[model samples]
Target: MASESLIKTSKYTKYTSYKKISYRSFFVGLLLFIVVSLLFIVVFNAYSGSSPRTDFHEPVNLDSTLLEVVNLKSDARLSSARVSNCTYWDCFNVYRCGRGGHDKITIYIYPLKDYRTESGTPFSQFSKEFYVILDTIRHSKYYTSNPEEACLLVPSIDTLNQHSFSKKHVSQALHSLKYWNDGENHLIFNMLPGSAPNYNSVIDLNTGKAIIAGAGFDTWSFRYGFDISIPVYSHTAEKIDSSQPDQKNYLIISTQLNIPKHYLEVLQNIASSSNDLLLLDKCKMDSDRIDYSKRCEYTTGRMFSYPDVLKEGMFCLVIRSARLTQAVLMDVLASQCIPIVIADSVVMPFNSHVDWNRISLFVPEDNVKNIVKIVHSVSKERRGELYWQLRWVYDKYFASIEKMTLTALEIINEKVFPLAARMYEDWNMPEHIYGPVNPLFLPVTAPKAPGFTAVILTYDRVDSLFTLVKKLVRTSQWHEARGATPAVHPMFTTFIMCDANRS
Candidate 1:
């Protein structure tokens, strides 16, 4: 009995010792798992943090002697472009701000001259604006020097305006440039700001000025521009009079002395009827000192600074001048004022991209009497919708100088550059280096003849054929009936023919 008892004690001790060992083994495995997990997390985080930094670093080639070659003679133009190469100290300077470096495009400024108008008005303002635009948006890169090394040459529209060079003369001059003589480099012509669209592409016999066709003119194949101007407004005055009760009413501020007679009559009629409508007309503007014509001398009315008037007005009147698009449009939009446009032919900048009808109300010039009626007819909900839409347009298109410059560059890249590339090579380049050649304005020819010739055959169906012939001939005059422009002059010509009559 004693031996059996001792054996049981020994078995119990061994079992207890085994249990203790099992517990320690479990704890050891758990510690190893925790340590491995912590190490993996630390390594993963380090790699992830370092990867983005390496990816974002701009590619730099430090070798000064290794020049980034921009071969203009090579017609290897890229259709999909994101990054532009700017040469710095003879090394390739790549900016990642544009689309990824695939399908790269190189842009350079023609450094020959600072743009100027014939009146000695310098385009330095635009140049400064453009440089800032390129920097902010990183859409283009500039070469320090040498037009020959650049594929695209951008000259300020104001410079062209100063030369009073028509598209033909400008084209000729571009052709005569030594760069063109090398059968390389193309000029992207910018039309003068605030000038009326000159659709008559041909040089005007009366005025030597190049008539930049109105914005959105189909015939304007080569001309491209962004006409955005910051408003000259007094913020202090606007804040001071913010509490005025009539501040939210309609205002028409014309700095020009002579508003169009039709537009003037319309304003007069609106003022005669509505006490809410304010007419601030002045014959002379401060711009007169700058030599820009404000208006012809005429009977004047009260004058108010632009911002003060713009602040008080909720609905502003925008009249179309020779300038295809006006600074007033940008001002009204930027101020968040609803625009009531009077010109039917007025084309908004980037019209092809955005819907203007969604943001502003357009009324025909002859229908000035309907101004108050239209304003009153708008529902409160609709007005709110228009206000938001106008605010959006302003923010996106003209909110800041940087944004405006970006807009111009976007237009060039999306609309102008591709078309220019296709048409650029087709231009009449001068034969000799610095050779004189007639400027070949684009589309290469006038619009195709408007009319088509049609032949009709009658086979013993005289009465029916005669009626059909009459209708076809009458269809030629449908444009005149609709009061359309003469651009649609003759629709078609008709010829009547007879086969042997079955009778």
Candidate 2:
């Protein structure tokens, strides 16, 4: 009986010890849970306090009437032609010439033929759209009735088909204009697909005064000099609150299946990996026929009607088509959605004046696969700052017709005025500057030895050689026969290299 009692007491002690361990473990686990929860709360609150908050209006209301602004006045000379408020369509008429503007320089726009056709509509519409801007400037004190009197002649889209697009003809037409020699006028060529470098209609006229647009590069080889690239915007621009939105999605890429296959693949990969929503409107184009009307109508209905589609997204993907830059980028900015540009090389309009880095995100074609990761690296605060930067770009470049026209005018002014001034100075200089020379008193050698030698190669032209020798012998006398010449004339001796093999 004593052995049985001892064994039962030992079993009861073991059961009590097990219960104590379970109670201790439960309390310790509860304490650990509370500590971790407090740490997370502290960290989250600190981050929220330190990070910048974007002041944004929710449920944005867009007003079409708000897009209207006052017309640009002629007397507001020195002011940057940027419009404070104006819709894209009506604003073209408001831009005026600034002080010391070129009243003699006229812009002659050749009416586009076949502009109404399916393929031609985009180019045709683009031509007409830009013409309004040019025409507005034309009426502002500088008007010319005759094409002969005009400083610049801009050919329409259909004109290319009429000319057979031979390089020689285009070159001659642009460089051989009446006032071209005077440096008072130039040719403005819009570099669309049919009008770009690859197109037969396109030719580098080598005219120093020519301005080209839509080409990938800013300056390219052409006649006399290369053409300068100007930013090309869409004729149709959207108006939204210039402020960035409180975005719900990371990116919204609306693309047709016609886009490069590689880009679509990358986008798919990004969509799979992304934590946020990735909106892709695969606007599939059915046929090969270039029908602008169908595409525009469909896009307007599907993509444009929903302005919230843009406002809800942080970045809009702008893929390069035939041209590096597109109207979509302008529209994206107008919608206040920051553009994520994917192109090989994109030259912006007035790029010299605006800093693009602050306004948009540029992703190289090769690095497109890593787009999600790259954008994810940017902090929310940085994105907010980029939004504000885009506002400046929209107000200055996209929404303001005056600003856009002024940028082109500024390029012409830079090229034309300097050459014209040099011509004027040479023409008006006093004869005394050349100094009188007595032709009869010819010397075997110049009074002062020339520091440089002027080598003249000839194939048996004795008469020309004799004339050149005389001019070198009496430098001042040569200027007397001609009008005012370059002040610094070559006074060096000519070493004529005659070909002995010439019969």
The TM-scores of all predictions, comma-separated, are 0.46, 0.47
Q: What tens digits encode model 1's per-residue C-alpha lDDT throughout 1-503?
A: 99999999999999999999999999999999999999999899887865555455433222224332222222222122111221121212223112322332344443333323344443333344334433443333422233323434443222223224433333333333443332222323233332344432222211111212223222232222322112212122223321234446553333333357777776776676666567655445456553222222123344455544565566777776554344556666766677887766545555545556667778787877777777788777767666666665665655665565555444434432343331221221213322343456445454323356666776976567656755665665333455433322344577989799796
Off by over 4 Å in 2: 1-126, 140-176, 181-185, 191-209, 213-227, 239-246, 251-258, 275-279, 283-308, 400-402, 411-503
Q: In terms of lDDT, which candidate is strongest?
A: 2
Please state the error at residue 369 of candidate 1 in Å. 2.5
Clashes in each model (backbone N, CA, C under 3 Å)?
7, 4
Please state every model's RMSD to the true fold in angstroms: 18.7, 33.0
